[model samples]
Each structure stands twice: as structure tokens, then as C-alpha cells.
Target chain A: MPKSEFSRRKFLGFAGTASGLVVIAGCNKDEVVSPGTLDGVDLGSGDIGILNYAYALEQLEAAFYTQVIMTQFSGISSPEATLLTDIRDHEVAHREFFKTALGDKAIQDLEVDFSSIDFSSRDSVLATAKAFEDLGVSAYNGAGRLIETADYLVLAGKIVSVEARHAALIRDLISPGSFADDTVINSDGLDGSRKPSEVLMIAQPYIKTVINGANLPTY
Target chain B: MNLSNIIDEIEKADGEAFDRVNSRRSVLRNFAGVTGKAALAALPVAFGSLFKKAYAGTRGVQDVFDVLNYALTLEYLEAEFYVQSLLAPGLLSGQLAMSIQTISKHETAHVNFLKAAITAAGGTPVDKPGFDFSGGKGSGDGPFKNAFSDLGLFLAVAQAFEDTGVRAYKGRAAELLGGEAVTTAALQIHSVEARHAAHIRYMRQQLGSGVGNLQPWITGNMSGIDSELVQPSYNGEENTMQASVEITGINGFEISAESASEAFDEPLTPEQVLAIVDGFIV
Candidate 1:
């Protein structure tokens, strides 16, 4: 607790380097490597690392949707409810799909912390949903190359497109004609593509699980 | 004429057939090898059904240069189409105008990016093909008669184009996998295409044509669109199967046919995509 001491662990925790922590621990590269959030879970190496990365996100999404349905936000319209339910089902299906596909390779279910999210507020929920969906698209796009098998690559595509659809729908609901706004799309006309380490970092706060993805394959 | 004879010939014949797999892939690979007069006498039917599936399969170890050039062609078509629309007088207004304007700029950027990518890869970029945009339904009497006047039809065509682009990128995704950086770039474009498709679908819904069940995601049940012109673009979209398993048939999980179909987007072959847009090119 001394003022002179730099809290590397605390800084990494706050920075959401949870998954990156695994890599530092596994690789003793002489240089000082910052660890991720304390007690972060391991995402397992290889395809399982990528799969766990996806499963972890799906779990967060499914939890969010379940909460949205449970505590109905005021002014929620029939169309909105119906649309959300469909999205909810789709997210659940996706979550279960990865869980089943990974099976023994799958990471344990993570504890999601949504205390900061105001479930009763429709705007808050939609904003969070939008972020999650957009991040999911980029995460998959970024992870596409890391996949060793053609079968898994195609499977990831199948899910990412739906996530993109959800992102577009949510963006329009928040503000019409804002689906592919400049925020996510770069000057190259390409959409956002975030690394697994980066995505997990952004998703750290929502997840309390310590995911060790240090052994994940890099292309 | 005989299936057994074809199988017998395949068993003994070899050379450039590629990796062998049972049933589907093997049938396609064998058909791939018999692509000339020398093999014609061995089989009569030519496995027409199997050929389509094989053609629709992955690029299977293609060079990066070929992938870039192929992608460049699609970008050129899209960028040009958007450029034409934005040039039309009073064609777009309000939110529709703004949305299409942003998309137009993005497509323009995509064209430039792909051209650069191809050039950097030491491949000659394909020449831009002149587009008719009217689907050749009539003479090039200005797009006013074709789609500009009516916002619904305009968005419908836009939806088709973006949807095709999404599938087009996906179909070739596997080939780019061998190159990490290029694969990331391709998927980035692919995701953007999906986002564009979703926005167009939303715009169509806003037009309030009472087009039931139109949404951002492809339900693959585009039978509601009722247009022969767009059918080729939407072909195979109705599939309720993924990873070779029927959507509803999965154990301990229940998904309505519609939800299952909506859950995943299928890839469209380049030929199928071209067939949809070729009529638009003069």
C-alpha cells in the first residue's frame, strides 16, 4: 500500500487484462509481463481457447437477455418485446451450441456481473446489447484466422453473421439509419476486428470468471 | 450411365483429384478430375448434382492473389452501383439519403482498399465491369424507371446486393485462411457487408410496404419476396441445416424452423451471385 510502489497487478485488473494474465504466467519471457484481472479463469489453448472465448460472451449475452425479459422495462412495446424474445432465443441457442460443441473442452460457466447495468432502463439494456453484439462480430472476425480447421472457421461465420444482424437491428432501434455508422467501420470499409485478448479485456468487468487463454494459438 | 462403373473408374483413376472423402467430397473430387474429353467416356451423367455442390464448396487452398482479385471484382460492382445511386437527382432523401450516402462512401473505400490489396499482393487487379443496374429489365433509361423513384424497390435491390456480398465473402473465407492477415481483412469486409444488408432490410421495413417478416437477418424464407430476379441471390438460404445436422433434429434443443434458419446465414457461390447481378450489367 506504499505510495512509491507501482501496483502492476491492480493496473492490469482495472485494465481488464484477465485472459492476457494466463499468457504472462505461462511464458516466463525475461521482460516484465503484466497479468490480467486477479483470479481470472483459463480459456484453454488451441481451438478450445477460441471456443471458450465465444462461449464466455454468449453466456453474458444470454444472461443479459434473460434479465431483460424478466424485468420488463417500462414503455417496452409489443414489437420490441417480440423482437427481443427472438434475439434472446437465438442467443441462448448460440450459447448452448458452443457449449455443446466444446463439451469437455469448454470452460466452466462464468459468473456475470451486471450490477452496473440498469435492467429496468430500456435504453441502458439496448446500449449494452448493441455493444455486446458489435464486439462479438469483431471478435469472431479477428479470431477467424486463428482457427486451424475449415469446419470451425465456417461454423464461426454462421454465428458472427447473426451477431452482425443483431448489432444492426439494435443500432437502428437506438437511432434510425445508424446500423453501419463510422464507429465500427474503419476508413478501409472494413468492420471492426478485435483480438481475443482485446475482446476479453473489454468484456472483463461483466465476467467474474478468470479465463486463462495464454496457450491459445496465434496465427 | 452406370453409377457402379463411375465408382470403379474413380477407384482406379488418379491424378489431381485432391483429398478423398466419403460420399459428398469424394463424389465432388472425382467429378472434378473428370473435367475433359479423356474422362468423358468413363462417365456419361458427369455427376451434375454433385458438381454443383462441389463448385459451391470451399476454394480449398487457393493462392492469395486469386482471392484478392476475386474480391476486387465484387467491390468494384458494389462501389459503382452505390456511386450511380448517389449521382441520381432526388433519388434519396432524409434518413434514407444519409444512410445510403455513408454506405456509398464505405463501398468506395472498399474498392480502393481491395485494389491496393491486390496490387500489394503482386496480382493484377481486375478491370471494373460496366454495370446496367436496371437488371436489364429494360434499356438503360436512367434508374428513375428502374428503382430510384420508389424507395421500396430501391431498398429491395440494395438488400439483394448487400446480401450477395455477405455470402460471396463467406464462400471464399476458407481460402484466405492460409494467410492470417489477409483472412482478417476479408472477414472485416464480410462483417461490414452483413451490417449493410441489415441496414437495407431495416430501411425496407421503414418504407412500410407491409412486407411481412422482413428483418436484418436472412430467414432464408425469402419466398415472400416473390421475385424471380432475386431468387438466385437467395438460393440455398432456406436451408435449416448447419454442420450437417437438421436444426430441429438436435437432441434436447427445440428451435422453430424459422428461428433455426434465421440463426445462420449460408454462403452463396460466386457464379450464383454473378447470375443475380449479371442481368444488371449491360
Candidate 2:
């Protein structure tokens, strides 16, 4: 209880180390290491990491929506046409939003090869759309904890909610009654979450930039 | 008992080791709350200012976890709704079952993804709890009938929930700012959610749920039949409904002022989201 002891502990607190009573833990570095190359994406350190991450997803969404609008599947009902066009516009806006937000920090426009997607057929288009949407939702959930500034976090949150909506819509389109079913929602009733490294790995094949995420920090 | 003499003695013995030991000891005392306030009071204005700054009081990572938990909660709600509706009697046709299954898998992935994230973040993944689609228990045909029967109501409610979710995620974006990987995944999910909202609106229109069920993003403010329900001359000669829906009959779509604008989602501070969330948590 001496003043010297009290001051010593306080000084240590100033150094930012955890309290002796505190438990310090981190993800098993080996467990979550991503397998694929980052493609060409460069998520700069700090906030830039987040911006690049968003940019990647926007690239995927823009491509998918563009295909939907361009092909205009045969037998597409009136509602289908209207909604798909609207989605196309939204994706365009999202792609541009990240571009503008990242400004000079933004990476080059991503190259997405959707030759893998069979746009001529509704089944093919919707299925791809569903995968992209679901991936988007899971990506955001996983990345939520990695943000630093509250303001950017808020921005990301707004953007991700929109993505979740996309996932729901795509689900319904593929199947009317499947908007928030077990396939998307887990037993915990929470959406999916993935770390950035994991997300980038999944996105690598679709993107061509060869992302170098080494500079990005993990929680 | 002279403080200066004791300090000199410690310094002469091994300044660096002494300093390190002293620093470690200080951290422990603060851990016990003996030095917290005084040390805080000694901080410079800028550092002190942080104390006054709004916290949204989310328990730092704990609250961030809460926000994630809430997100998971909503995700599950939507996932379950879809899963049940797909199989609900008289809801979806057997022909649509295959598509529903694919969507089902996606939702499943979503749930698992969040579970992993929460686990990664050192928090317990919330187990799925039984959700009440219907407002109450014991209502004869019960919840499914209520949620599934009226396609219009179903679509409308879904729209509202999705919109709210989009806003909610945005509201909590800041809390996740500390971590990069998590933030990136969140933004990806946010974009998907928006698309879902637009797609659902399309389905509502296809099924003739309601006239106003046009895509909100596409709709600025134009008049169609639904606009007639409102007072005539809602927006000068150019109907708001016209801006709202893109149709051949509407003379190609005229971009509304709202459509041309840079629309950012309104942020709900962490404190705000938590306050509301607490009401529902238990």
C-alpha cells in the first residue's frame, strides 16, 4: 500500500501492457492463415485495409449485377426485370462509393473474369448472384471486428447491411421462401463472419490484383 | 521516509530494471483502482478530452461482440424465416424448392461464418434460440400462418427489417474499426444486404403484394397507380411514382433528385444501437 508501489503500478499501466490479472489471447496464427494469393488487391495499412477489402467485394457485386442487367434473361417476369435493373444501379453506386472514399488510396480497378458464370441462363445467373450475395454477407460479418476508427466502422456497417439485404434478395429470387433460412443463418441466429485473410482467399480466384495484405493488422 | 532518497536509491541500483519493475507495479495498482482517477486527472487536455467523448458505451470489444451478436441474431431471424417459409404449407411451390435449398445453403454459410468470427474474436458464438415469427404463442394455426399467409405483409415486413438492418450495421460500423479483417468482411456483408432489399421488392411487385412495394432505390418520387392513393398532384406534373418505378409505360425512367444524390446510410451510434438492443436481449 506504499505510495511508491502504487505509482509503480500506475507507471506500468501507462506503458499499455495488460494488467497481471488480465488474460491476453489472440487467434491461432497457424489456424486461420489464408491459403490463396491476394490476387492483386493491396489493402494498405490502417483504414486502407478496410477500404481495399470493401473495394474487392464491390468489384464482385458490380460484375454480377452488370451481367444481370446486360443479359436480361428470357422469360424474365416484369418484376424481375425491374428489380434486376435496380440492383445493377445499386452495385454501380457501391463500386463507385469505395472508389471515391478510398480516393488516391484506392487500388486499381479489379479484373473480374465471370466467364465462369453462364449469364444467358436465369438459373446460372441467379445461382452466381446468390453465391456473391451470400459471400458478401459472410465477408462483412467476419470483418466487423477488424476496424479501428468508429466513423469508418459506421460507414462499413451501413454498407454491409446493404449487402445482407442483397443476400436475402438473392436467396428469395432463387427460392421465394428462403430469405433468412438455416442455410444462411446458423443455430445461433447470427449471420456468418470471416476474417479478412479468409475472405481474400475466397475472393482471390475472382480478382486479378494479387493482394498483399501483409501490412494489414489483425485484432 | 524521504521520497527523493528512495527514488535515488532505486535509480542507482538498476535504473532500467527498476523502471520496468516500477512500471509493472504501477499497472497492478491501477488494476486495483487505487491510482486510476488521479492518473487520469493528470492527463493532458487532449487525452482527458477522450474521456468526455461519446462512447456509445459499447463495452469496447465486448460491446463490439454484442453488435456482432445482434447482427447474428438478425441473420438467424432472416435465415429461419426463409427456411421455414420454404417448407411452410401453401407458401412456396414444390417447383421452387431447389432454388430455396441453394439459398438455404448460403444462409447456413452466413451463420457459420459469424460463428467463426465471434469465436475468432474470443467471444462465445451465440447458440440459435427459438424465434417467434408470429407476435404471440398459441394462436391456432400459429406463427407460420401469420408470417406466411399474406405475401404482401410478408414482403413489407421483410423490407422494413432489412432496411433497419442495413442502418443498424452502419450504426455499429465504428465499433469494429479497431480490427481490419473483421471490418472488410462486414462491408462485404453490408453490400449483399442492400441487394437483398432490392430483390425482395421486386418479388413483392411480381406477386402483386402492394403498389408502393416498388424498389426504394429505383424510386425517387413518381406517380403510378399507387401514387393515386395519395393526394393528387403529389409532385407538380412529374409524378413521384414515375421516378419510383422503371417501366416502359413511364416514358423511360427520369432520374429523381434523390437518385442523383450521394446517399450514405445514417449512422446509429453504438450507444443508441446498444440501448435498443438491450431491450431485446433478455
Candidate 3:
């Protein structure tokens, strides 16, 4: 059996014996909480947890782009507008893909906190888009090693490259010829990667939901 | 011939051959006890199970080393392409030249990093292969012979190489999964290649010679170049089914097939990539 399936069964076994709440001990003595509690949503465990993590990010990206298009930042050019629209559609597609793939295991729709983002200004919107795209790419890159299923790893690979492509375009729009600049691509010619804990902490301000990623695998 | 005799002959040709073999002994350790033809006959199944076990947890050290070497070869090609392009007088200038220069630097870095990684892993880095860049198989008279002289052709070929690099790295990702540090490094490189691909595509879109209307991402399986020589790089990219999920109209949304295909980049097998790359290799 795949490691993910085996771990899911083990997690369910714990859930089965517990009362209303199940607080299992994590690898590093952290408390691994269950989902749908007052503490907020737990991303579950194993492959499902990773999928939900991706889903949550995609939700934020999709919502941000949807609002961007609805407001249509002032002075947006036709090409820029068209590109953002395409990105919005792609984000929505990615969001739906994870939801469908996860099925009953999928997490609930995430509430976004976009108050700090001024969608009216082109600079704000593009900069935020650039941050999200780079974060998404790094998140997937770091998470690849944690995935046990070959198919899921391949699927993530498929999506991450698209996210990278979106990142480059957004960066270019901000500063021409800055697509693969030193800020993201390192001295070794490799892009940066962020652990789930690091990624979620950075993403917490933009997200309203408290995500318990304690059960997610770590490298 | 006796094994000892063969080893002696190899050592004569290459002084570091034993060290190279010893570095990968972990992968060959199991073969030490099996010598008979019967044991050899059963070796295939044993090797399969061995690899399967390795895939389940940590991959073999040699596997990671080999993948790095493969990546190093491609980086050599890309680094040389950009290096030669920048050397060509009046080939590129302004923003285009700057962008190409940035990409060139990254490729050179990739080559150096991969070489260091292979050396660290006790494997000799593969020598940089000679390239034609014209798809002429070293005859220097291929269809893209004027790639350096003409800006339009340079961008087109650049697009092809970057896109191919993205797909090629992705295809080999599964092998590096269990090796955490290497997996992360390869993925980091993979996405950077995607960024390069997208930027090159944008450059091509702006040029509008034959690649006008080209999205930064691949639309379908279209190479966007109309050249059969580079078509293999884009073949199978139109795939919309990922992990058996049909991306088009999933979740009851009216998503077009083109958009669905565009949202995900497909991988090209090593053989497929090599076939496309061989045209430019001598």
C-alpha cells in the first residue's frame, strides 16, 4: 500500500477511538489536532494534508484574482488585463482541480483577508500576484519530497511549473527583464523553496482561517 | 575474460575508474555475492524489487548521482547556447540582450553547481558536449542556422530549449524524490527553467515574426514554431488528463480544453528529450 493510504488509515484509527476531539502527538512533540474544531481546520495528515495545503493556497489565489478582475485595477492595459484574466482562470482551474481530486477529503473554502491589498492600484495587484506565484512555486517545490504517491508528485510537478510561469510573467510586468532575477533565483541558478511551516506563517496574514499543519510531513 | 583482468584494463585506461566504481558501491553491493549464471538469470527480478524498495523510501545514491549528471549535460548545452549568442556581435542588445545575459549567467551557474554536486557524490561530471545550436547535427547548416544572426530565430530556438529543459527536469523528478536535498534542488532548478521558458515565450510573442500570439505557457501540443525538428519538444503537452482527472469542465465549470491544457505543463521522457536535443548535439 502507498504510505499515504497507510497513514490515513492510522489517523482514522486514532479518530475512531477518540471522543469529539483527537489531539495526537506530532513528530516533534507538537500537537496534531483534528479538523472541523474550534481551533480551526487541520489539513489532516499525509497526502491529503499536502493536497489541502495546496487547495488553501489556490483558494486564496483564485479569490484574489477574481476580485482583481471584478474591480479591474485602474489604468490596466488590454494586454495586462488579458494576462491577469488568464491567470485568474488558471487559478480557478487549479483550485477546482485540487477540490475535485481531494473529493470528500478536500478542506472547506478558505476565507481570505485581502484588506491590505489595494486592488485599485496596478502596482499593488501585480506585486501581490508576484508574491503569491513565487510562494506557490516554492511551496510545491518543498512539498515534493514529502509526497509518497508518484502520481501525486507528478501532478504537483505539472501544476508547479505553470505557477512558475505565472510568477515570471508577473515579475516581468513589474520590472521588465526581472523574470529570473537574483531575488528569487539564487546564486546556484536554482529557485527558492519554503517549508510548509514557513510558507503558512508568511501566508497567515492574507488568510483568515487558522490552519493546523502539525500533521503534515516534514523533510 | 576474468573480472580482475577487465578491471586492470579499465584502470589502465582511466586511473580514477576504481574510485568512481567504489563511490557507487552502495548500489552494486548486492551483486557481490551473486556470481553464477543461475543467480544472474534471477537478477532482473531482484533488481526490480531492489529499485522498488528504494523508491519506497530513500533512493540509491548512484541513482541521484546519475540524474545530476544527466541534468549537467543539458545545462552544458543551454549555457553554451547563451554564451555563444552573447558573443555574436550585434546579435542582441538593449532589454533583449540583458534578458539573455541574465539567462546565460543562470545556465552557467547551473552547470557549475551540477558539476560540483556530482563531484561531491563521488561521480565524475560528464564532459560538456559540443553543440550546433542550428539543429544541424553539427553540420552548422540546419533550418535555424541563422539563429545567432537573426533575433527572431534566436528567441524561437531559446523558447524551444527552455521549454524542453522544463519538461525534461520534471520527467526525472520522481527518481530524486527520496533524496530530500537533491529533490528540492532539482525542483528549484525545474521551476527556474519554467520561468526561463515563459520569459523566452514572452520575448517571442513580442517579436511576432512567426510566433505572434504565443502565450507565455504552452497552449496545446503546438511547438509554436511550425518546425518538425522541434516538434518533439512539445508533443504530448496537450494532455488534459492529470492523475486521471479530466481538467476540462471539471467541478461543473465551463473550462475550455485549451485553458485546461495550458494550466499544467506536461513532462517529456528522457529519451524524448534526447531525441530533440540530439539534433543540436554533435
Candidate 4:
């Protein structure tokens, strides 16, 4: 399913070139431009912090899926292509939802480093999907309480369930009939969850912007 | 090159403009149990599925410590379930085996991490306990055989336990927010648990057990001809229902992800948990 001309490496080079061009063009702007505090880079002082955190992850997902679409993995079948595409659309919807929900408080567009990923291979892509899906689920679980508004929490629940779907699909892709096996489910047939601070640490390397999560209010 | 000049130049243009910016979002009250009474006294008073009794009368560090202990208790129960299920005859295959093994390891890791965090926080970890999923207190075979033959029962119990775990983490997240290291690890493990629940539900779908495995709180449909299994609020394939229950204290709080009424697993308070778990050992 992959196009021969558009390798993930090639895509990165293009994105980097585009960023470089932007930097050069912005030389005349006279903003303070401190080490931190970009416009819309939510410092996460309170409940918005958790929402910002989810927003950041969603940004990463949208970026990854955009790249996936740009260069489909080689040797992928039609059903896999269709499923992956659906997942991509869902992630995009989630990304936009968070951006809209957070409005001006949403974090800026994050720069992702997926150079370590070999997207040409199905195994590599699915493995990455598994990781992202798993991380997204944990992110929501960890940040759920920090959210003050019930509407926001419910929104998170909705988004996280979508992540859970991604996790199921990725698990099955890795091995059929393995969806919801004991590994994802404990013996009691339940799932696991993590907190936001922990989830951010795992997601940080892939994200470039500084997240001011330290000052966010907690219980 | 001049820092003060840079600060002044920007400050002059928008000193008052900063006031128009939104205030930092407020931290939420502990909607689950924010009555401000003794932590230990909040027991047995059920808030949906989590029994209020679990947290009564416990003091400052102890209250936080109990939160971890409660999480540990749930993990232990889940861990034990996997340990036994893995050993059960003729029950698993392919990706299922690997997934279960990995989950076992994850649970073990969670238990260890929580134990360490609790001790580091200067509170004693709650000892592990044997979880009895059997509804009937008198008959052992009824529960065991039912778990094996009626996969539906097994999934229902599984659903309750997983859903409880998901909410348990949500309830206790406030306590961990103070410690970054502990909070990060707890959240990671919590999400893993959510994935596990989804996976289990997917498996049930494959096996055609047709329990409302996907949405635990909202029941939609079961394969059998029983009204007990028919949840009204689920929006999945079986029912176009929506969740009607709501949680007080929190604005816009919907208790069930799905809008159906099926079998609901009651919440356990820390005190009720202690009482129920008095003699149990993991």
C-alpha cells in the first residue's frame, strides 16, 4: 500500500525543511520569545493542565496519522488499510475536539520525532500503534481526576474509549484472536490505568515543547 | 541582548492585557468523597460502585496511603485472577496467552510500585487478600463451575471488577498528584488496566457470549433470553439506549458511559472494603 516515493525518512526531511523555512521567514518579528510561553502553550496551571496534556497527545496522534496517510506501509492489505484509515480519522477527530474544547488554552502544535520508527514495515507501524494507543489510554486515566468539569471528564472518557479501540485493533493486528486477552486484562478481566504526570514522562521524548505541568493544581 | 529592556518592551504593550487572559483552571473537589469528614469515616456509603466505607477515619498521610492501599488491593485481586486463569485447563491460545502473561507481569509491577510508593510516603501498605467473586457465600462449586461454563457470568464479574478499577484510579488520583513519580507510575498502570478491560470485552464478542461486556455500567444485551442481562442505555449494536444516571457534587457528571440499566456493581468504601476484607489474605 506504500507509495515508493514517500518514505517516512523523506517525510521527516520535508517537515524539517518546512520548519527551517518558517524560522528564517520570522526573523523580523519583535516578540519577547522567552525560553518558554509560546502563544497557546498551556502551562497547565489547573484542570486545563490535564486537558492540555491530553491535547498534546492528541496532537502527536494527528501528526503520526497524517504521516501514515502520506506514506502507507508496504505489503498492507485492503482491510488493514481501511481500518488504519478509520483509526486515523478518529484520531484526527479527537485532535480537533481537544483543540476546540481547550480553545485558546490548547497547547501549540507539537514537533514529533518518529525517526526511530520504520513505517515501511507493518510490524513496525503496528508496534508503534500499540504503544501510542496504550499510552493514550493511560494518559486519559491518569489525568481524569485533575479535570474539574464533569463535561471535560466525560469528553475524556469518550476519547479514551476510542484509544481503547485503537489498542484492540493494534493488538489484533499483531496477533488475531488476541484482543482483550489476559495481558491487557488482569485475571479479573479488568484494564489498567496510569496518572498524568507519569504519562507525560513517557510521552515527552516524542514531544518537543516544554510542558509546564509542574504547577498544575492537584487534589 | 538586554533582558530588562526586553521584559519592559513587552510589559508596556500588554501589562493590563494580561488580566483579560483566562484564569488558571480550578482544581476539582473530591467529588467521590469531599464531605471533609474523617477520611476513615467515609466508608460503606456507596458512591455508585465505590463503597464509601473504604476511606473512613484515616488521617493525612494515612488517608493518602490508604488510597494507594485500595489500588493495591484491586491490583492484587486482578493479579490473583490472572494467576488462576492462566493455570485453568483448556482456556487460552495464541495472542491470548502472550497478552495474559504480559498483563500478569504488569500487575506484578503495579503492586510492587504501589507498595514502594506507600512505604516511601511513610504509610504501611495494606496486606493482600483473596478476592471472592462468587456471589453465593455458601457454595464453592456454584461460583467456580459457573465461571467456567457460563462465560457470561465470568465476563460480567470481570466487567464489574475492571470498571471498578477504572473508577478507583479516578477516585484516588487526587492523592497521587502531589508526588510526581508516584503519580506518573500509577497513571501508567491505570491506563494499562483500561486496555485490559477493552481487550476482555473484545474477546467476549468473539466468543459470542453476548454479555454487555463493552459497557459495564450500561447494560444492553446478552445472548440468553433473560431481562436481567438486558441493559437499556447502551448505544452499541444491541441497544440505542443512553446513560441516565448522574453523579452529584460534580457538574455535568454522567455515571454510565452507556445509557442502559443492567447489572450494576456497587462501589466499595475503604471502610466497607476493610470490613469485607477483614480475614481475607492474598
DockQ of each: 0.31, 0.17, 0.36, 0.10
Query: lDDT tens digits, residues B1-282, model 4?
Result: 122132233233222211111111100102211112243243432221121122333234444555666677778877776676667676555766676666666677667656544443334555564454453332343333455335455554555455446545644554544433334345555555655665665556556644433321223334221323222112122322213322111123222222212212122333433333222222
Cα lDDT tens digits for candidate 1, B1-282: 222232232223221233212233223222221112243345433232322223234443224445666677678778888887877777888888899988898888877776555443324455665666776623665432467666666777788889888888778677665455567777877888888888888777667755678877877658235466687777787777766566653446666777777778888765666566666654
Best by lDDT: 3
Error of 4 at B257 (Å): 10
Residue A131's lDDT within candidate 3 is: 81
lDDT of each residue in B143-184, candidate 3, tens digit only:
889999988878889999999999988888777766555666
1 against 3, candidate with superior TM-score:
3
lDDT for residue A105 in candidate 2, whole number 0-100: 89
lDDT of each: 0.68, 0.51, 0.76, 0.50
TM-score of each: 0.80, 0.54, 0.83, 0.55
Q: What is the lDDT of residue A91 in candidate 2?
A: 62
For candidate 2, the lDDT comes to 0.51
B1-282: candidate 2 lDDT, tens digit per residue: 222232233223222211122232322222112113344355443311121132334345455456556667657766786787676777565534554454455555556666555554345555564555553332334333365665555555455444445555666666555434345445545554555555555556666734554543423333222323222212221212211332222223333334332123444443444332221222
Instruction: State the DockQ, from 0 to 1, for candidate 1.
Output: 0.31
Candidate 1 positional error at B209, Å: 1.5
Q: Which stretches of candidate 4 lie over 4 Å from their true place?
A: A1-50, A60-93, A107-128, A134-165, A176-219, B1-59, B93-95, B141-145, B149-156, B209-282
Q: Pairing residues by index, what is the TM-score of model 2?
A: 0.54
Q: How are the candidates ranked when ordered by lDDT, highest leading? A: 3, 1, 2, 4
